[model samples]
Target chain A: MHFVDRVRQRLDDAELQHNLKRTRGRNAASRAAAVAAFPDFDAVRARATEIRARVLRDLDLWLEAFEAKATESGATVLWARDGEHACELIIDIARRHGVRTVVKSKSMVSEEAGLNAALEAADIRPVETDLGEYILQINDNEPPSHIIMPVIHKSKEQVSALFARVHGTAPKTDIEALTHEARAVLRPQFLGADMGLSGGNFLIAETGSVAIVTNEGNGRLCTTLPRVHVALTGIEKVIPTLEDLSTLLRVLPRSATGQAITNYVSLLTGPRHAGDPDGPEHMYFVLVDGGRADLVGSDFEDMLRCIRCGACMNHCPVYQTIGGHAYGWVYPGPMGSVLTPLYQGLDKALDLPQAATLCNQCSVVCPVSIPLPELMRRLREKQMEQGLRPWRERLATRLWAWAAARPALYAWGARIAVRYLRWLADGRDRIQVMGLAPGWTAQRDFPAPAGATFRDLYARRRQGRA
Target chain B: MSTRDDILGRLRRQLGRTGSGLAEARRRIRDEIDTPRSGPRPSPGDDPERFIGRARAMLSTVDGCATMDEVPAKVAGWLRAQGLTTRLVIAPAFAGLDWSGAGCEVRAGAAGPHDAVGLTGCFRAIAETGTLMLRSGADMPPVNSLLPDTHIAVVPRTCIVPDMETAWTHARAEWRHWPRAVNLVSGPSRTADIEQTIVLGAHGPYRVHLIIVG
Candidate 1:
């Protein structure tokens, strides 16, 4: 089935409706609180955009500085041209370290690179320590339903049952109890794992540091307790300095979870130094380009400014109705509509760019101001130019364009269509069983076209008409 | 070309930049980083009372201590009130604070999983966000503030910074060489991943109590 039909099916799923309603309510409150946290939100957004634009303009230099500084700070920096290269570097590290078990923090980059499968193929077990990710990991068929909240589609009762079946214990109905159960299970993994992998939120070029923001303490544990730490990050995550990092941090938590500050914001430079009590002994950074560089100076370069806060999806009516799984990709909502196609080819992900209503809510809520609707429109134009749309839709569009060029033919066509539609309506105001567009009239009636075209109505009014 | 050269070359091509432009960009970044300017930030009014108020509002219990000697009693009392164990793991940096009178069994080192409480002295506390800044060193290790179920931090009132920018200035001035880890912790470890309901202590300390010494 096509993406449209799948979305339509999911739009009516009872389980999905129940899940999305809860998220809508929670997101509404968080967005309100986030808006209230900042005295001058727009000014901060403008500055952030300027900083990102500067970084993107000189991305290669900043990356070079980052590599040099991080190496000086005792970290080994490696560059990967694509996801395959990134995965291979990580697997090779695992092999050399004799890593039997790996504990991972929540990282969208690892998801994009398909690192877990690669590690598994090499006989190394990877454990997801974040509670939401752990749930998705156990249920192999379910991808993350939301970026921040991976198990947004699941309920506590369902989680309870999953724990009981997977861990071989009686299901506990309390929410806190389930959380404690996950902590108990993942603690040993943290203590015993030879290596830990995480995604970088921002790689500071000045301090040779990686800034990670997480509400849960798993990020701190994953980066600290393991002997070897590997951070897989996109090239676009680099900032010029710690001062710049401070500005980005101010907006990130507010935009992400409405917190004045997240519980833990770790600025880790390299690994543990000599005489330091406890941290990773060695550190490695894999900077994955993966098609982001393709948009450096293009019209779509603005999309790279996204901080992955999930605010666009939280405010999107289309996404809230269909949920994230309907988008069928790593990213979802307005950001995903532009990114999925650009990152994973426009041919396979056509429905994503077409899914938006171009309401402009996403643009207003975006922390860095990406102009998402305009980008989506550009993607649609690109798709049409590439001849990726269906032939019937293309033919209809071309016919309308051709008729629209000549007013007399368009007026005549409109008059004939209204007359035929008046007969189809059978004297009723609406037509339920119409051949004009069965998809539109499938569940509800389409209103009859006022019984006269606009030109006819204007002429009749000029002639003292009814 | 190697992968590094290839990746950088592709970026240069897409961005329409020449080799000469690279030197200029590097210089600009270096100048900006050397002379840092603060950006638009929230003005929470950098005062001790406001800092304490904000810290309390974030669910962190803040108690005022007249001197360094008063920190142990407060930690012990808070622990007893909360029914936590009296066996505490103190950071080596804070080994001078007397814990004998507080009636608590104290050990100074990295925190273990079985340790219920860990105490440390913070580098600086920011008033803007009620955040405690901790730097990793021989004296103040990272795990002392993270691994334990309960974290009790002792903050000297003079070490409080007006905002995050001021904290950065202090950090640069004090540690010319940056520490391995610089943590800005605000409140206890928490998560909203479970059906968007906030649950405290997902993997770190469930309770974070602050003892402010004057």
Candidate 2:
């Protein structure tokens, strides 16, 4: 579907709006409180940004170190050039272990790779264990609208209806009751699953470990209990040392959910060792390239610093109004505007860069201080340079440029433009009809020019003063 | 050969690096790993009182255990106060704590589906966020604290570190060998998936009771 149509349709959705409204205030308030609690938020953020920049500069070296250390620690580190290659590697691991049921925690990397569908096609049953993710999984495998809260777009009542239909249990309208029902259904799946897949928030090179943070214990359960554990993470996730993990950790949970730290922070180095009573016997770390390398040292390289906190989406005005699905991919909001276009070609997501209002809220709240609006602006410029923008928009830009270069002609054009708009407005403050730009006024009215142009007013004032 | 080279080559190209200059970058990262740098962080001075205060804010129940031997009695009193059964799953790592006087049903081993309360000792207690860092091995299953309805963790007053950075420093200095799994658990497992309202014990412990033992 077109991005504009999706946005229009989403705006009309009362339930989605209600759900977004419920979280918008709470998330923003809690995040503000969490940020207030920190005394050195910006200083620590700068330190983290430097760390990310250092890693990106020497990412290949860090990966080699991580691979060597992980290999020595008895973990097989696999690399993939893209998402399809990532899915293939995961499938191969499943087949080798003769696994059937695979339980997964919330992994945006897997979502980007479409791992669930690939596993299903291979006759492997993939179960989502996170409460929010499980809701989306049972409801026809909808891609997450938010990264941290995958089903933030869903309401409790809708979830109750879903549970009654899917679990064959009575509808649970209360949030706690609904949570318990989900736990009852997923606990057995955790104990009985043959394999587990998770996404790593940070892959530590010093310890050759994969670290994950979750408010729910599902991540721990998925990595434990199951005989085989496979962690699929982006190559950009690798950090040089455990100290770097600490800095990122400080910012991640606070920015993600306004928690000082999530309930569970799992730092797993490798599979279970001899005499160890629990943990997976087999462990594999698949570092997914997935076009992340394409942004290395590019204009949008700072974007790779995102920790999937969902703060960008939480604070974004555009995201709060229209929600995430309208952006048309696993990622959305300000970060998505820059990332989706860069990761998936600019031509593929032409409207994403223009979707943002360029308010810079995401950049200010970002833990790593990524210049998100600046990156989005660059993407727009790239679109113009590559001729990826719509022909009419391009033509309009050209015509404006032609008139703008000649000051007298520009003044003359502005005078005529205001008159035409006022005539269209028919004495109202806003124009109800637009000739060539009907899409702009179709949904709502466009504010009309009041009287003469600003240039004319300034010129008349100068003459009167003289 | 896999796609390692392809991915790395792309990164190297973008970073404007040649084969001859790669060794210097590799050495720098290895040196960084050996002697890690400490960046700006919240100063959580090692104070047991502050730890208790923070833990309380996160909804964890804290009780004072005057000594290691008093853990059993303190836990027994806590369980009774909560109106929960005395039967608890304990990790063999805590055999030194002596839970015989707790007057509670104590089973030792990994957590099972039916266990209501799981008790274990943490590798270190982080005073910054009032979190317990538990490392897997030495007959102490990480799930003993997880995979249960209620979790009772024993945090030694002496083992309390100022923050995560200090915790890692202590782990490196003493542990020598890294445990397969290291979990930093705070309060209890929770979820705000439904309308952003927190519901504790979504899949883990509903209540996390901390006994501050000296």
Candidate 3:
């Protein structure tokens, strides 16, 4: 489907629009608060970027060292080349552990690898314990629409309806009521589950520790309650030391939700200590490459610098307008647009690269300064080189490119196009056309090209000076 | 591909010739290290009060919360007003408190899922970041703080620090003797998934009442 059409569909969903509006307002307020709180927010962002860059540059050395240290601490480390490999590794662990029920906190890596479906196919139940995730899971729908808020697409009323259907009881419209219901259901699963799965926001190479951040206590319960704890994370999550982690911790939550820090930041070094009263006995860390290693040396290496703060998405006009589902991936918004193409292949995600308006707001707001817009442009260039562009678009761009190279020809062409557009617009100064450009004007008016070309205006001004 | 096959394949591809041997050697090394180290260690070189100040600053920046002497009454009133009163699991730190006067039933120890409220005392409060750290143990079972409809934490004013670094140092020193899960809570649970709507109490406690006992 066309990008505009998909966005329109998401916008048409009243619940999504309502939620987006509220989240946008809250994020704005929180971000302002965070900025006010951290006068060194920019410095923290820069430091985080530098640390991440250093880690990515020496990824192999760090990975080997981290593996050695983690294994020494009595934790098993597994490497997966891609999502398929990651899923296989998890499934194997589940099979060996005889995992009948799995309780999960919010792990973006699991979502990316489609771990839930893979486990269920093997007859293992995967339960999402995060309140938002639980609501989405009960609905039995697609992956989360937002990175932090998985069910951002569902309104409280919609959630209430879904809960009522799943539990065979009328759900309350109140937020507390909804949360209480989810907690009631998930608490038992946390105790009964054979394995607990989570995603690490940052992995400390020096300490062999995985840092999991969450607001609700699910992340902690998921790691400590179960006999087996599995952490899935991209290789880019690694940092050199706890000091580096501290720098990131200072910035990530502030950038993400405008909090000084999340409520729960659990750093697990290894399995339960010998004398420790609680915590998992078997701890596994799955480091998935998933096309990230290739990005290490490429221009897109900066993408790895991301801490998944979701600030870019939060500030993105397109994201705020259409929401995440329109991107059609686990990682949505600008980061997703850049990553989906890289991981899923540009051909599979042809429309995603074009999802943005090249506004550059995403890059400006990005904590890590990934140059998202430039990377997106490069993806578009690659798509064009691959001849993936539609026939009509290719012809239009080709014609424009030809004219653009020669200013004299471009001026003449522009003059003719402007006259033609004026005629088409008649006296109204607006024209509704179908085909490729209709999406641009579907809900908003497209101003007719200015009556006078830039060359014409410039020449008239010069003449007036004469 | 099977999980074993996948893991084996990864091991072979990444580690080459030393993969199997290294795996075995690593396992042996872990088994060999049985006793905890008790050697004299260098000081961390950071000041406790400075870290506490930082914690306080962080909490203030993040809109940290604190309760006062009137907190018990406020909490009791809030819970009662919310029409929720079944059973409360109180932390050992809260043992000396007079709950009978507040007209609330309080049980000591971990709370079951059916329990209406879990009441505990925060070990440390970071004022800079506005966070409360709760360590799991006999008195503060992790479940007592989690797995309840409402979580009421009684944070002493004295334990409040300024930043996480101070909290970390204090926790690390405490864990050297007895290690357990340390939970740092900043605010009530929240989510913004539905069109980015910020909704509190997604999957955990919908109501978090801090009874700050000065």
RMSD of each: 2.7, 2.5, 7.3
DockQ of 3: 0.21
Inter-residue clash pairs, candidate 2: none
DockQ of each: 0.82, 0.82, 0.21
Instruction: Please state the CAPRI-style docking class of candidate 3.
Output: incorrect
List ranges where model 1 is wrong by over 4 Å: A411-435, A443-466, B44-46
Per residue, candidate 1 scores C-alpha lDDT tens digits across A338-409 of 999999999979999889879999898888988999999999999888999899988988999999999999
DockQ rank, highest first? 2, 1, 3
**What's the C-alpha lDDT at position A109 in model 1?**
88
Q: Candidate 2: global Cα-lDDT?
A: 0.89
Report the C-alpha lDDT of model 3 over B117-139, residue by residue, as the tens digit.
Answer: 88877778765555777876666
Report, for every candidate in turn, its global Cα lDDT versus the true structure: 0.87, 0.89, 0.73
Q: Which regions of candidate 3 deviate over 4 angstroms?
A: A1-5, A11-26, A418-443, A446-466, B1-124, B134-144, B147-160, B169-180, B187-214
lDDT tens digits by residue: candidate 2, B173-212: 8887789999989898899998888998888889999988
Worst 10 residues of 3 chain A by lDDT: A429-438
The chain B TM-scores of all candidates, as shown, are: 0.95, 0.95, 0.64
